[model samples]
Target: MDGRQDEVAGAMARLAEGDRDGAASVLRAALARAPDDPEILHGMACVARASGRADLAIGLAGRAIAILPAAHFHITLGCALHEQGHLEPARAALHVATLREPRDVRGHAALAAVLGAMGRGAEAEASLRAALALRPADAALLHGLAARLSGRGAHGEAEDLYRRVRDLCPEEGAAWANHGAVLFALNRHEEALAVLERADGLVPDVAETLNNLGLVRMALGHLPQAGVALARAARLAPEDARIAVNRATILAELGEDGVAERLLRGVLADPVAAGGAEGARAAFNLGTVLLARGDLAAGWRFFEARTRLLPEGRWPDIAPWDGVAPPRGRLLLHAEQGVGDALQFLRYLPYCLERARVVLELPPELQRLVGTTPDPDGLIASRCTVLRPGGSVPGDVVARCALLSLPHLLGMAEPPPFAPYLLPALSAGAGGGERRVGVCWAGNPAYRFDRRRSIPPEELAPLGEVAGVRFVSLQHGVAAGDPPFAMEAAASGDWLETARAIAGLDLVVTVDTAIAHLAGAMGRPVWLLNRFGGDWRWSAAFDRAERPCWGDAASRWYPSLDLFRQAGPDMPACAWRGPVAAVCAALSRWRDGRLAGD
Candidate 1:
């Protein structure tokens, strides 16, 4: 090799090894020898990028490309421009680099990155797939494609690709960590935990790996272990607002609300964080903590952060309806979250019906059930039209608002009137003479925090020991397991049928699921099994006493619902033993009371 070429190669090696000063020293000498050599200029560009001088790197790379028009020089230029946030220019440079050398993986990879940064995800995936076709077993290419698929919610396909990456590059800690994340998204929590732990072992000090480890541990209800992992991650990446937000969430779960609040506020105060996803998360979490503790005014304001967190496409196209003056024509009330959220907010429909001709959009499962929602004078039936998804919105619907936004818009300091807003759809002789108690141990698994709220069927065994209470399975979607207790009423059917069954029951004992909200709305006695740091609807202080103290407006929103919170922050690692036991004791008292009356 020529001496200048050899010097350029050595400088590239130094840059790869993270010795930017050594790389610059070699590149300086090589540049002096051959002032116009594109190879030496490219080497200097690499050194500049490693030293965080994206502007200098872009200049050097441009000079190299100008001198030789090499594909590699263009790739360097594209990456430097991307680092400088010039996505359009970066995309142009990378596209040129790819056309100059279609066989080069570096050019394809760089181009894909620019495309992804430009939010052209489909085109970026196509680029990665094209590269993968050329080099099918390339670990970096496989990992990149897998990440894109995972981001787009093609988790099963992503998991398969991530598996291939693990096989091709067993020592790649990043591949392992990402594989774990896809598994977690697929709701394979145990496998995800194992994979993340393996990743942590492989890259012990990496903040990302540790953060993933913390999340998996938290999912498994191992709060103390999760805390340790997150603490290490926070120490490693103190400036990372995402990591700080995650740690604060964990602390909130552990009942360290003061510490969590401080950390979240600190994150919110950082301007860079305030402008991104992390800032929105911090705001939402702060709102949740405040609402859980009954700080209503600030809580509702910050709780609106959830609106900011929604994807741009999810927003309604029409202008928002301010709750002040009644809409001149029609008001559209839409469901933005889950069925439970819809159920919780449907109470406000009557108020809107009183003002304007209302259109309520909801999931199809809710259509039949919503018919039974409280309407003393049948105003809802007369004035409101229910729209299922894909059902037409009338062109004259002048203004729209999210259902959850009603409380804030109405300027509610406390919940309006939470008396039974839904009527039971049953006849007089529906339930048998015995005291039938419907029980649900799980919610929809697709919920992001389902692991925290759901209980294993076995955890309900203690209730079996209670005498005279007939426990019926109210759980749907999940296969009903053989519980230690006998079910007096069988489980099955659509949400309306479930509502019929719940109406016949003497009481409902349920985890924090839609059923709990349904029964509460029906004014059935509801024993809500709440996890540590439960949903904002159940005030955090609910766990303090033998029976829930309904001092907070959040809790007061469900008058018929009684909470059985996990005993302490330490619980749930014990797998709902405390709450289940409390439910058993409460059920025994209820049964005895009923028998005495009979």
Candidate 2:
């Protein structure tokens, strides 16, 4: 090869070795000889990208493509644009690369990636299939299709493809990692661990692979193992913001929020680290830390970053109410979170700005519960198996907002009045005054923290022993079976009957579940058995300090409800202990009033 070509090859070698400075130096010399050489310009662009100079890389790649119109040059430009979050332009550039070299496998893969990011799932899958047909067993193409399908929520199909990729190409580290990720997404943690271990064994501990393993381990409640994996990942990739965020989460779970807060803050301060997907996540973690410390203003500000983290089309087309009082017309308020969250925030409806005319869109399971309440202007119950725009709503809706956003929008410095928001009853009373008490021991199992929040049925045996207290079951779901206490079966999936049962009860005691919120909203006497160091909303530090509402046993959020926290320092979050003895002791002090304390 001639001297100019030799210089280009040497520059490429330096780029491959991650010596971007040396690569650029050599590329400059080559470009000096052949000022318009596409190969030299492309080599410089790759070097720029290696050093995190995406704009410079795009500029050089554009110059290279202008000279030679090569697929490799456009591919480099597309990749740089993708990293910078310019998906549409990236897709256009990648499309040009595919046209320039129809059989360019990497170009097709890059195009597929950009298309997926743009939410064009079908086109992305087609691109992958086209590339896969050329090299049917290629690990990259197979893994691409597998990841695309997984992103589409087809975990079963993704798992099968991921299994094939791993088996067919045992030496490829990505195949193993992809298989493990899909398994974890499917809630098959044991299989996920096995697959991740296989990947770690093959690659011997890449930062991303170890990070995924740590996440799966954390989900399985193996805190020590998760800590070990996450610590190692942080060491390997100290600059990776996601590793720091994951480590912070584990630390918070272990009740070490002080250190976790510092780690998350450092990630947010680093511009490069706080950009892309990890940026919004760091903001979220920081928001939780601030909220836990009772810093509402800053906490809510950072918490709003959640919208940026969410995927496209997660909400409807209506403009979200920007914390403003409407002139007229009904505001379409919808529940965007879990049942418990929806129930908990309903207290804010009466306090809405200017006594706003509000309509609600709730899941069908919650219809019967809301039916007892006469507050909302109107209610629309619908099934949301697949999300889309324009849910059933009344006409003349001026704006929309998720129910969870109300507290922040209202600038609520303190909890609203704890008076009963839901009406008295929808069904006839149980007709007896034999000290009737209702109990719930479990929450929706699909909740991420259900294991920590739910008390095992066997642990509730103490409640059954309380003399003169009729223990009725308010428990729902498949977990509803024989409570240690006697429970009359209400119609399955019937929430109104459960409400009626609660209305007739002298007191209701429950763990952190939707029923807890329901009983509290009804202004009935209730005892909330909380886990140690639980969700921030339950923490005494969550509310303003001077109002004197939060105590060890009292909550500002609900005046009729008393809280009984599990013993701390030794009570693990994943334990099966119940606070029934606390309830029994309080029942002994009861004066037979509607409120527990009275």
Instruction: Give the clashing pairs for model 1.
Output: none
Query: Which lDDT tens digits does candidate 2 get at residues 1-598?
Result: 3777788888899778878788899898778878898899899889888989999999999999898988889899999999999999999999999898888888888899899888899999999988887787887688889888897899898899899998998887778888998888887877998999889998876998899998887766666677789999999999888899999987776678898889988988898878777889988877777776777777767876676686325346667888787777767777766788888886776565344667777766677566565544432222111122356565677787777677678887556666776764645647475877778888887665465677767677766766767667788887787576566654345566667777788788888888888887888878888876667777766433333222246666776677777665333333435356666666665634333334
Against the reference, the lDDT scores of all candidates come to 0.82, 0.76
Q: After superposition, how far is residue 588 of candidate 2 from its true place, in Å?
A: 8.1
In model 2, state the lDDT of residue 324. 81
Off by over 4 Å in 1: 1-107, 110-119, 311-315, 352-357, 377-383, 427-429, 465-467, 481-491, 540-555, 571-573, 594-598
Candidate 2 regions exceeding 4 Å error are 1-141, 167-175, 201-204, 271-276, 310-317, 328-330, 353-355, 364-368, 371-395, 429-435, 456-470, 481-486, 542-552, 566-574, 578-598
Candidate 1: how large is its RMSD? 5.0
TM-scores of all candidate predictions against the true structure = 0.81, 0.69
226, model 2: CA deviation in Å?
3.0
lDDT of 1: 0.82
lDDT of 1 by residue, 551-598 (tens): 112246676777776766663548588778767766776777732123
Residue pairs that clash (backbone atoms under 3 angstroms), model 2 = none
